[model samples]
Target: MNLDLLKRTRMYKGYNQYQMAEGIGLTRQTYNYKENGKSSFNSDELLRITTFLDLSFKEVNEIFFDNLISK
Candidate 1:
């Protein structure tokens, strides 16, 4: 995952980690772990993030799937 892009986007949208966790029905620590790459985001969490961030399909692909595409 492109964590830097994700963090930047989250900040740009004016959401803190706690708010994002609430929005996505996760605990703050869970969100932090996922954000920091200690854990992965499930598809359901990804969907919630896309909706909460108001992200476009292209943005989702860039932030979540860029590594796969690069390979």
Candidate 2:
């Protein structure tokens, strides 16, 4: 699920999971599952997360699309 990417990126931005979740309009548990790779992110949530994290769409798309294609 590339949880490491999620965790590392968030940590690199100096945001805790709860804070990141709040920023992206997700519950802490839901966001945790996403970050921990226990659940898949819906398209809306994925867009929100990427935008909230200030990641370019292309960058987020690359990461997510790669994961999907690989699986």
Candidate 3:
């Protein structure tokens, strides 16, 4: 995952970690762990985040799947 891009995008969209957690039905700590790469986001959470962030498909790919692309 492109963690930096994800964080930057979230901040750019005016969302805080707490809001992201709530939006995705996760606790803030869980979300923090996911964001910090201590844990991974499940597909449902990824979908929720995409919707919540109003992300385009390209942005989603860049933030969530760029590593896959490179490899």
* Clashing residue pair totals per candidate (backbone < 3 A): 0, 0, 0
Error of 1 at 6 (Å): 0.6
TM-score of each: 0.90, 0.78, 0.91
Worst 10 residues of 3 by lDDT: 62-71
Task: Encode model 2's per-residue lDDT on 13-66: one tens digit a residue.
Answer: 899988998998988998888777788998898788788878765556555665
**Candidate achieving higher lDDT, 2 or 3:** 3
lDDT for position 19 in model 2: 97
Better of 2 and 3 by TM-score: 3
**TM-score of model number 1:** 0.90
Encode model 3's per-residue lDDT on 1-71: one tens digit a residue. 79889999999999999999999899999999999999999999999999999998788889999845542
Candidate 2 pairs with clashing backbones: none
Query: Which runs of model 1 end up more than 4 angstroms from their true locations?
Result: 67-71
- The C-alpha lDDT values of all candidates are 0.92, 0.77, 0.92
Tens digits of per-residue lDDT for model 1 on 1-71?
79889989999999999999999999999999999999999999999999999998778888999845532
- Score residue 49 of candidate 1 by CA lDDT: 99
Query: What's the distance in Å from true for residue 21, model 1?
Result: 0.3
